[model samples]
Target: MYFYNLLSKLKYIFTLVITTPYYGWIIFLQIISGFFSIAGIPMLIPVLEYIRTDISGAEKQGHMGFFNYVFSFIGVRPSFYSVLIVSSVLILLGQILVFVSTTIAQFAQIKLSGEYRKKLFNSYLAVDWLWLTRDKSGEMNHAIIREVELASVAHLNSQRIVIYLTQLMVFLALSIKLSFKVTMLAFVIYGFLIIINAKNTSYVQSLSENFNETFKRLSTLTANILQNKKFFKSSIAYKGFVSKVFHCIDQTMHTAKILNIREQLQISWTFLVTFTFLICLIMSHRILRVGFSELLVVLLVFQRLSPQFSSLFENYLALNKNIPIHQSITHRLNDIKKNKELCGDEIYQFNKSITFKEVGFRYPEGKRVINNINLEIKPCQTVAFVGTSGAGKSTILDLILCLLKPARGTIFYGEISHDRLDIFAFRKEVAYVSQ
Candidate 1:
């Protein structure tokens, strides 16, 4: 259910699933290989115990299930020795499969990470100029890098979730073979672990925001140093720039240290639960009158289950933490996307002159950058505008180029409001080279 919500927002889910055979194939193979490894565990403990006792006839008792089924099919009676040999082979093969699968996943992760980074870069490149000015360069850097890193981390962690889920299932089957009561106890403990981790979602989200802010401050500090290097090196300002970078780094480290401390505290709770589970096993052994093998089975099951459950909860918390950052970055990106210039519109056709009639303009904040004005230009005439600095000269050019729309009056080309003309198309027909 956690994954259900997680996967819902990532647009790349379909791509990830469809490419699973391509990207996550090794992981799937490892899971299949791991099943054999888990099943062999039950067989192993008994064999070793029998060997320790030096019993001669105990050989027949150890060889059962898959070993017997496969060997019997091949018209061979799998001796205790033979089953032991076969199980070792299966275990070795499974180990190799898991290693290879993880290796492949890491490689695929790098490729996908690069692809996403490229897409983000292209999206930024295609957007309008306004975004470049509105968003500080450092903040954009912070957002882009944070998203890329998270996407990579999430993708890798997501793959592991599959591996862990497979391992859990194998362990669940083994636990069922041991005792239904023990398995149920383990399941309840796992559910509790999940709830504990889920409760930390708000903290995780807050941490993510803090992390981004730290990086942004650092990025801004760095950018300023680079841009003002001359000013820094020429005067006593060098110390000031150095001080700012240190200040940002100091804040970044402070937040980071707090998060690390919290994580360590959380780990203590895991240890507490593990100790409780161990106590539960002891009580269950005496109450249920379970044999040594059954006790060993429960212990082994808990050994695997504790780490699995703990990891599941930790990963969920981490995912929740990262999702908010991912969402924030995406929101900014989408805003940039929405602010993009319109494409594929019909080019406006004008055969006569261009004119501005009783025109006026003001910025969005209502600072009047332009005053009432009337102007005309013939189809093929060269004209010049003369005015002092801040005398609405640049504003007039901005209005004509359609970079800024006038708040009052009209600009006409052949008696039509120039606003109706495709601004992009109009710009192509007329070039205004500015100083």
Candidate 2:
């Protein structure tokens, strides 16, 4: 049962990620960049072969691709020097493609940042008054500002992950085409190394989650401490606040340290594995009499592949880190959508008295905030609710405003229950001041 539950949650997280906002054109650009990146791999093969012997003979005898033909048609001779320049320029162009694609993707993210914050704010405004008071506190403010920002970032980070994955696919395909046996051997070694470091990835993800939680708590604490600074002037209150703040910071630093250590360990492990693979390739080449050109190409692939895998791994971890923020904001938005305070179809025309009759209310903890309250107010007549703090004054006004539904009895505008009145129109005609 636990395994199935975990499986379901994993499915949901990935589904949420893929469904997040992404620019289709930017993704297409990255896809094109992937091909551009892969072109350099094949272009290197002949260049390496050309370097093994006489450059003129190697170039005159070697097969060249369409790019070589284009250079030739433009009056550039096909030779080792030409192939060398072509490969370097092609790689440079690929870098440009990646840069251009990332820039556009970032632009899309900047546009979405405002949109996501607006989405969260509008959702907050639409939430039932009772729900806000009932649910857990400290999550709302940070989620609205910080987590929503993180959510906007998820689209950009997710796009980067997709681009990395695309590049990996292209690199792997071309490396295999260039030298099947070497590619297969490298894949096994690197695949095994990745499996070994999979636990580290999970650990990093766990640490990221802890860091996110700590940061949110810190935000709440900072706000709370500043608002209640009077309490903190005393040594006892100051000590308590300092203790909590320090604990949160200490925990955050500890988690960050662990993540950093894991990253270092993973990088060190990748270096060791790649080095071992190179040695084994050399030994295998000596036995199989593999061509030097193949060795050089394989070495080139390994050099690029090592960093690719490392970055891809890091990006995968980023996906995990961003998932919670996305889910936090999205789940809140979705919950509001599901449990919204729906308005009635009735048009509100209030020119008479608003009355509350035998209304009772309690909080989620089952403590009554308002009990058996009765009040009435007429048009053009101002009234005040005067009570000590935490008395039912604000709750009563909220009840009158239709922000909170009564647990017992009714609130009426004229003869109609407030629920039947158009809430938007009613609120527009009414306003409240709070303590």
Candidate 3:
């Protein structure tokens, strides 16, 4: 079950990535940047070896076999200064790549968020009036605004995950080249760390879900209160309404607090475990009897490796937390698509009269508003519907405007049925004034 869920989440993320503009370019930049970032690790060995030989007053020879071959191939003699300069160049190039990639990614994030918001807003406009009325305005607002923002964040995090994973793989490969046993041990430690944090990851996802729901509720409550401020202020139930708002705010804060605490715990636990592993590595150095320079290089590799591992794990957690937000936005978008208003292609034209033939209408879950009604008005004629509150006057207007379809019978414009007429063209002919 867990595997299936994971696969589904992955597929969703992939879909999001592919749909995003410039995603291919961004990924290409990230891959190249990852390679540049780790290209300096192996150079450390030769540079350190040269420094050691210089300090000991020993002859500096190209003892780094692989690096020597590489230097030769590049038409550069393996020397302390040469290797140092090349390593510095590689690191500088990596930083430049990082900067370029980050700039592009930030631009992409903004563009993606804007696109999603526009898409969602347009979908809301196109959806059936009944469904739109049934949906909470504040919830829709939150989805268009906050949820889309989180989706952008998720996209950025996924990109960072790619970069981190690449760096981690390179670090592991380099570490293995230096010391296979130590590299394997480090891999095992990382695996154990993942196992230890599995529960925390799940808990974080739950908190994320709760956090999203509470915030959405808070938004809805706030919007409702603001929209009906006059009624709430003039009525005796104002305190109750205010309390509900406060309760929603409190729930949102509480969920955020727990989520933050979990994040802190994850960071602290990773640090402690990795620090312990570092200390053990240091303490076992003498027992292992490895050469001083080689051991130093190995320690350097592990030093870099530890943070990459931690970052990769944290990225995974962040990605997991965002899954629910993505799912919520996606589900809402799908619902909007499903409820999209239906219309015919024929243009509506009124030549003589607007007529109703036994027209009837009702709320989806309420008593009939109008039934067995027949009426007509010629062109340029004015009609007034008089009724008490909850009467079908507004409903009748909506039906005449073709905003709401009748439950029974037919409405016509000079003998043409309402459903057969194009709603947009019909609406263009209407000039409505409403209270």
Candidate 4:
């Protein structure tokens, strides 16, 4: 109920209307679709109730205000015939809107997803080669696909918020006009339900994240093995690798099984809470001094609004479940962006000259790969460094190529310090062939 940080973070997603004109149309249509559908259901409920009560005619039914005006505008009074006609029309119109809206929104979702993927592709295109090699290509591919998918569904928040708010307002207005006391009592029960859900959210979110990560790892392991089927058939090492992968998968699946149980339990609790709330509302209305017809109408409206409220909670849970993965992907993307920025506008422009002035480097293990190494490659001259395996030959080349920065010294490309020079621009002039 009071997730300030989460709410703040989600604001951008909810503001789809203001964000872009294209998404605005998608949001507008989706909102209209859900509203008309939900409103039509509730609008017909009273008509069905009247019919069930053996009321032969709708003239005895006293209904005024918006629905009455709507019916009257079509030359139909508040009779059973008019109610039937109006409800049928509303239902038909609602269905048509739903179809059109879903089609348009789906098209927009696909378009936005394509755009998101293109942006990530462009990022890869613009980034330097060094950053690309730092991670396995498959991992980067996964990250790109996953992150862009996240961006693609960003409009879901907008759709939910708009639909829920509109439904809540319409239902609340109708309910209050019928009986304010009943509406207030329903809200109290809803508030309590929300509080209970809030208490369990943290645990639910943790379990969700754990389950997702385990599932992803399991998928990645399988994909990696399948992609290297030839190597697995030929190499002795592949057996050990496959065994390790299966072991990891087993452990992950075991955890996932437990998480699945917890998730089912959580879902059950949510339904239990909702059912309890509905029971309370029914009991309260039954005991109240309100007339049977009024009670029936109130209960019917509550039945509709309750689900809308439940939808809000469901969306909240979904958002909580996804936030961790979304954040992780966002973090990785930001790191990639930072790396791209750090690599300046230097494209490979190596005119056969590269220098390392007392270069030094330490790997992540704190072991020095190159220490105080000084080297020079003359312009257009054939030069080679040969040594036993594990010597600093490749390390020196890595430094000269500006792939790894020196810890103790500097590299120069044509008298320009590599760090100060536009690395993106300088890299364009360089060609690397590594064994």
Candidate 5:
């Protein structure tokens, strides 16, 4: 089950990366930068060893094969200053690549958010009125604003996870070269820690989902209040509406507080475990009979690995939290596509008169608004529907304007049936004034 969930999360990350433009370039840059960053850490070990040796010594005491190979490759003699310069150069190059990659990733994130927002907006515009009316305007706004932003952040975090994983692999490889047993021990300890915290990760995901629901409710409530503030304030229901808003806000805040506490606890626990591991490495050096230089390198590697582990866990939790938002957006887009307004090819032209022959209309909720209505009006003729508010006056107008299709019978533009006429082109001939 755990492995299946892990694969699912990985697939989500892969889909997100693949959908974004220039993501290939971003991953490539991240890999190169991660290599440089972890590769530079091991250089410090050789440089430290070179510095500890006598300046005029004919040979070094510790293993210098790695440095010797690097120096030979660069056609430079193995000296303290030479190794130090190369180490600094490698670290600097890593930082430079990191800066470049981060800049591009950030740009990609912004572009992605904009593209998603635009796509969602276009979907809203293209969707039929029936589906649009069924959805809350506030929830749609929240998806376009908050949900998209969170999704973009999730994408960025996924990229960071990639970079961190790459660096961790490099660290592991170097640590193994220095001291295989210690490296394996550290790996096992960290893996155990992850297993221990798996439940917390799942709990955080639940809290995130709860928070999303509460916040969306809050957004919808506030939007409703804003839209009808005058009516709400003048009516006796003002207190009730206000109380509901406050309740939603409280629920949202409560969920957020718990989520933050869980995250902090995870961080604290990770730190405690990492500190204990570091202490064990220091104290067991004698028992392991590990050489000073190799032990120091292993320590350095583990020290860096600790934070990478912590970051990976943090990002994983965040990714899980935001996955629902992405899923919601996908579902929304699919619904919009499914509910797209119907269109026809033939252009509508007004000639002679408009006629409704035994036309009937009813809403989806079984509201029979119009029934068997026969109507006709010539071009340039002014007509008024005289009926009470709940009557089918507006429904008849909508049928004429092609905003609503008839449930039975046929409406015609001159001799052409409404179904054969392009609704958009038909609307072009209409000049409506709404109250």
Candidate 6:
């Protein structure tokens, strides 16, 4: 059950929290963009092979793959300069596609972020008032505002994950074509780092939630302190104010620093692997007597792939950090509909007297606030109940509107019971003015 809940939240972050429901085309664009971003990765192999063997103004070197096809299209004896131009053009096209793909990712992210906020806000409106009242002011404020922003970041990170994963695969494929030994070394170094990081994912996740909860508590505390500064000041409560909470907040911040350090290490470990791979490649070039151009291509590919891979790694850490906000949002909509007040078909008539017969009320798990009240209000009557603060004035008004049902007794709306009437229609007929 616990694992299923976690999986559900992860799924929610990807579909509901990060993107719109109608995101099939957007996801298709992501895959296509990812493909285009790495188009140039393998082009160098065929291009360089063509340049080295086929067009060196010597014994004819055989052409293959894309380069071979292009030469076939030209259908004439080609100059060395023409081969260079063809390769350059292919690389240029790849770069253009990469740029276009990036633009598409950014555009999709903007559109998805807007859609998530709208979807979440609507879900908030549909939540049960009982659940809504458990938190401060309508909803968890961050769930509406701050968490939505985090969700935008989540979208951006997810896009990076796709793009960078594609780039890594392309680079590895090219490296394998160049030399199996060099590729293995590259794989071992980076793969080890990923494996080590994966083992700590649970710890990282816990830190994420701890940081989120602590920061939320601190935010609430700060808001309360400011809003009620007069009460706190007069009560001599400002001196030790927030001391324990601040300690908790500070510890959470320290945990955040630890997480950041780990993320930095994950990224730095990649750089270390890159440099190590470079050194190993140079040694292999000297020992294996491989062509410098070929080795250089492998080295350049690794260098290019590293930054994207690092970006991907950092984004993974960031995504983990922000997923709690995603889960909180999905929780709002999940299994919550059953708790909302159900409406009846009947609408109460207000033509006759409304009666509260030995009506009693209390919040769940609390002492009764409205106790055994017997009252009646006739049509066109003006009546008021005077009470001190903490009295049940607002509770009585809420009961009249059918917002709160009596705990132990009955309330009647004209000739019908309150529960039988449609609360929305009943409330509409009555006017409530609150200051």
All candidates: TM-score = 0.75, 0.84, 0.92, 0.73, 0.93, 0.83
How well does candidate 5 match the true structure in TM-score terms? 0.93
Sequence-dependent TM-score of model 1:
0.75
The true-versus-predicted C-alpha distance at residue 304 of model 2, in Å, is 2.0
In every candidate, how many clashes are there?
A: 0, 0, 0, 22, 0, 1
Candidate 5 Cα outliers beyond 4 Å, as residue runs = 55-58, 66-70, 428-431
- lDDT values for all models: 0.68, 0.74, 0.80, 0.64, 0.80, 0.67
268-373 per-residue lDDT for model 3 (tens digits): 8998999998889888877766567878888877787788788877977897788678778888989999998888777756667889999998889978989989
3 or 4: which has the higher TM-score?
3
Candidate 4 lDDT for residue 286: 52
lDDT of 4 at 315: 59
Alpha-carbon lDDT of model 1: 0.68
List model 6 lDDT by residue over 205-240, tens digit each.
678888777767766677677778889889867767
Global CA lDDT of candidate 6, please? 0.67
**Model 6 worst lDDT window (10 residues):** 57-66
Q: Kindly report which residue stretches of model 4 are placed more than 4 angstroms away from their true locations once superposed.
A: 1-23, 26-62, 65-84, 91-121, 124-142, 145-158, 215-244, 266-286, 289-300, 341-352, 355-366, 370-376, 408-410, 420-422, 429-431
Candidate 2 clashes between residue pairs 3 or more apart in a chain or in different chains = none
Once fitted onto the true fold, the runs of candidate 3 whose alpha carbons sit more than 4 angstroms away are: 55-62, 350-352
**lDDT for position 147 in model 1:** 66
lDDT of 1 by residue, 287-394 (tens): 766666567757866787677666755655565556555566667768878877543344555567778888988765668877778888776666788888888877
Alpha-carbon RMSD to native, per candidate: 5.1, 3.7, 2.4, 5.0, 2.3, 4.0
